[model samples]
Target: MTTAAHPLVVRARQLATGLLGPHAERVDQEGVPASHVKALKGSGLLGVNAPTEYGGAAAPPAVARDTAEILAGACCSTWFVLTQHYTPVKLLASTELPVRERLLGPLARGELLSGIAYAHVRAFPRVPVRATPERGGWRFDGTVPWYTGWTLNDVMLLAGVSEAGEVVFAFTEAREQPGLRPTAPMRLAALSAAHTVSLELNGLWLPRDSIVLRTPQTKFAQVDRPRNTNASPAVFGVAYAALDLLEAAPEAKETAGSLRSRLDEARREAYALWDHPVPHERIEERLAWKLRAHDLLRTTTTAALVAGGGRSMALGSRAQRLAREAMFLLVQGQTAEVRQAHLGHLSEIP
Candidate 1:
C-alpha cells in the first residue's frame, strides 16, 4: 500500500522537481548553486520551519522531515546545505525575542542566508574560538574548517570560545571586512557541490549585538537527544532513492526488502521518541535508534552498489553520489566509536 503525501510534502516534491531537478546533477559537482539557492528563496521554502510570528511557516517537525527527505532525494548536495541552515535556524527559533528580532525574520525572508562552522576534527584543539572584550562588542579570532555553503550564505552561525571560556554562538555577516577570507574548497569523495569552505578570521570585530545566543553549559541530554529528528526524514528519502535504484537489479530485491523493514521500524521508534519523554538513562537507547537508522541507510545504499557491479561506481553516477552523501550520516555530530560507546552505556543502563 502507498502512503499518501501531506499537502506541504506534496508542495515540496513539486518544487524540488520543477526548480531543483534540472540542476541537481550539476549542483552535486559544483557545490551549492547560487542561483538554485536564490530560486529556493523565491519559492518561499527557505522559511519552511520558521515560526509564523516571524513570517515563517512554523512547519511541524514531521512536516519539515518530509520536506527535507523529498529535497534530498532530488539533490543531496542542495539538501545538505539546506538542512544544515534549517537546523541552526530551528535552534535560533528557541532563543529570546531580541535574538529572533535581530536574526530570524531576515533569515526566513531569505534576505540573509546562513551556514554553520563547528569544530569536528579530533586533532584540532578543542579550544573555543576566543572572543575578547572590546569597546562596543567583542573581537573574534580563530579558524573554522568545513563551513558548509560558505559561498552561498550571507551570514554564518559561528561556534567559538568566549573570553569567559564558554562555547558561544556568534552571528557573523559577510561584508567588506579586511580579515575574513575563504580558503580553497576541499575536495571530497561526495557532496562536493555543497561548497564547504574553511574560514580565517584575523582579529575580526563583532559588536556585542552580534552575539545571538550563549550556552554557559549546554544540556546535551536535551540538545543531543532531538538532534536526529530533523535529519532523519531526509535519510528516509535517501534510503527510498537507493531502493528505487536497486529495483532494476534482480539480486537487490531481498536486501531492499530488509532495508525497507528496518527503515519503517526506525521511523516508528523515532516518532515515538519525539512524543515521549526521553529519560537521561535511555540516552544510549535513543542513540541506538538513530544508529540503526544510519546503518539501514548505509546498508541499503551499499547493496545497490554491489548489485549494480561496476556501473554504479562510475563517475557522475547517482549511486556513487548517494554513497558519498551517505558518509555524512556516519561522521556527522558523533563518530562511530562514540556512538558505539553510547550504545554500550545504554545497554548497561538497567
Candidate 2:
C-alpha cells in the first residue's frame, strides 16, 4: 500500500545515498558521529510509521520496510540507532496515556530520539531487572544487559518485572543520574558505532505517570514471542548489500544472481507472513522464513568475501564490513524460540 515515492521513503533513499553510504566506512572506524544522527532527524525518516497527526509520515508497513532496507543497506549503525525510535512510537500509538500526549509528538516529529531497553524482559524466568513499587513511583534495580545508542539517546523505554508478575515499561532521560548508570560502550563485532551499553540500575525511580505499559507477563509474551519470528527487513537490506559487492566482481556475478533469486523468494515469504494481521498465527512458517533469511545473509556475505579474495581482508573493504554487519544482524533481536529454531536447523546434517 506504500509507494516508492512516499516522501519518507524518498528521504530515506536520499539520506542513505548522500550521507550514510559515503561515510559508512569511516563511521565504522570512528563511530557514528552526531552529525549522522542530525541528518536522520533532518530527513524525518525517524517517524516513517508514526501517526500523521503528530507531523509524522504515518506511512504503511511497505514504506517502513522499504526505508528500513534502504537505510540499513547504506549504514546499519545509523539505521540501528534510529530503528529504536519506531518501537516507542508503535507502543505509544496503541496506548492512551498521559505519556502519549507528552511524548508522541516530539518523538514522531523526530524532535526526540528514543532507545529501547525492554528486550531484556524476554529473559523471563531470570528477571534480570526488577521494579519494586514505591510510594509515588517504582524503584528499578538490577542490570539491563543491552542498550544501544546509549549516550546518543534522549530517552529510553526501560523495563523491569514487578513483584506482581507484571512487566513495567517506563520512560526516562537516558543518562547517568540518581541510580541509573551506564557502563562504557561495548566492543562489538559490528555496529559498534551505535554505542551499545549496559545499565546498572540501583534505585532508579520514575513517577507512576511515566509508566507506559504494565501488562501481565502472559499478555506481553503472547505479543512479544512472534515479533522476531519473521526475518527483519533489515536482514534483506544487508543481504543485498553483500550481493551487490559480490556482483561487482565479474567472476561472481552468476553466483550472486543465483543467490539473489533465492533471497527474493525468501523475502517474499517472510514479508507476507509479517503482514498477517494475526501475530500468533503461522509461527512455524515465520520461523522457517527467518532461518532462510539468516542462511542467505550468511551465504551471500561469505560469497562476497570469497569473491574479493585477499582484498576483502582490508579494514576499509566494503566486503569485509558487510560480512561483519551480516554477522551481527543474524543474532540481533534473537529470542529463545528463534535461537532454538536456528540451532536446531543448523544441527541437522546432510
Candidate 3:
C-alpha cells in the first residue's frame, strides 16, 4: 500500500531518487554526502521542523518523520545527519527568542550544519568533554567519543555536566573555536557519509548568554520531558523505513508482516496516547515507542538477512547498511533493566 504522501514527502522522494546514483555510495561511506547536504540546504528541506518565525517550513512532526524515512531509503547516513540537525533545531525552537534569532535562523536556512557532543562514559562523570554553570555560562572540557557530521557541521550543540551536577546544552560555532578540535573521521561499518569523529574541548569558555537550556538533577527529565512530542513521528518513520526495506525482499514476507503488525500496534497506542488529555503521560509513551520501534527494526532486519541467504550482506545493498545502522538504536538511553521496566509499563497500558 502506498503511504499517504505529504508534499514534503513527495519532494524528499524526488530528491532522494534523483541523488541515488551519485550519493548512495558516498552517503553509505561518509554518513552524509556533501552534495546531499548542499542539495538539502539549497532546497530548504532541512528546515522542515524549524519554526515559521525562523524561515522554516515549520512542518509538523509527521513531516519530519516522512522526510527522514524518504531520505533513509536512499541514504541512511544523510538521514542520520539530518535527524541530528533536526532534533537540535526542535530544541532551539523551545529556547528564548534571542537565542532563536541568533542560532535558529541560520540553522533553518541550511546555511549551518550542526552536531552534538553529549555522550561520555558513565564511569568517568568528571571526564565529560563539556560542562556549563548553573546560573549562566559553561566551561567545557573533555571529549565526545563519537561525534557525527563533525567535519560538515558549521555549529554544534555541546552538552556537558555542570558544577552542580546538572546537564547543560551550549551552542558553539565549529570553525571559529580553537578549543574545539575535530579528529580524523573514523571508518564505520555503515553510515559512512555521516563523518563521525572524536571531539576534544579543552578550557572552552561559553558565557551565560550562550547557554540554551540546562537540566538539573536528571538530564533526561529536563531535555526529554514527558511532554516532548516532537520526536515520536521521527522514531516511527525510521522503523517504518526499515520495515519497508524488509518488505521489498522476497525472503522477508513473514518477517515483514510480523514487524509491520507490531509497528501498527505501537503506532496506534502512541497515537491514542497523543490524542488523550494526559499531559505528562507521553514521556512513558515516547519511551515505549522508541523501544518497540527499535525491536521491530532490529528483528526484521536480522530476519531479512537470514532469509535472504546472505545476499543481503553484499556491498552497496540497503539491507547491509541498515543492519549496521540498526545497532545504533540499541545504545540510545537508560539500560536493559530500565528499558524492560518501561516496556512493562507500556505492555500494561490498555
Candidate 1: residue 195 lDDT (0-100): 81
Once superposed on the true structure, which residue ranges of model 3 sit more than 4 Å away at CA?
1-5, 20-22, 119-127, 130-137, 219-222, 225-255, 271-279, 282-289, 333-350
Pairs with backbone N, CA or C atoms under 3 Å apart (clashes), candidate 2: none
Q: For model 2, how does the per-residue alpha-carbon lDDT over 98-161 read when each residue is reduced to its tens digit?
A: 8999998999888889999998898988799999999889999999999999878899998999
Candidate 2 positional error at 184, Å: 1.0
* Two-way lDDT contest, 1 vs 2, winner: 2
| Weakest lDDT window of 10 consecutive positions for candidate 1 | 119-128
Candidate 3, poorest ten consecutive residues by summed lDDT: 222-231
Model 2 CA deviation exceeding 4 Å by range: none
> What's the lDDT of the predicted structure labeled candidate 3?
0.67
lDDT of 1 at 7: 60
- Relative to the true structure, candidate 1 reaches a TM of 0.86
lDDT of 3 at 199: 79
Sorting all predicted structures by TM-score, with the top scorer first, yields 2, 1, 3
- Across 1-350, the per-residue lDDT of candidate 1 in tens digits comes to 12226566777788777866666666777667778778667656678889888777776667777788888878878887776678567767987736667889888876777787654322123653566667887776777666788667788876666655455667777543766787887787777688877778778777767777666424422454455332366677787888877877787777778778878888788656655564433555556677667777788788778877898767667777778778765665664445565467557755
Q: What's each prediction's TM-score?
A: 0.86, 0.98, 0.80
Q: Candidate 2: lDDT over CA atoms?
A: 0.90
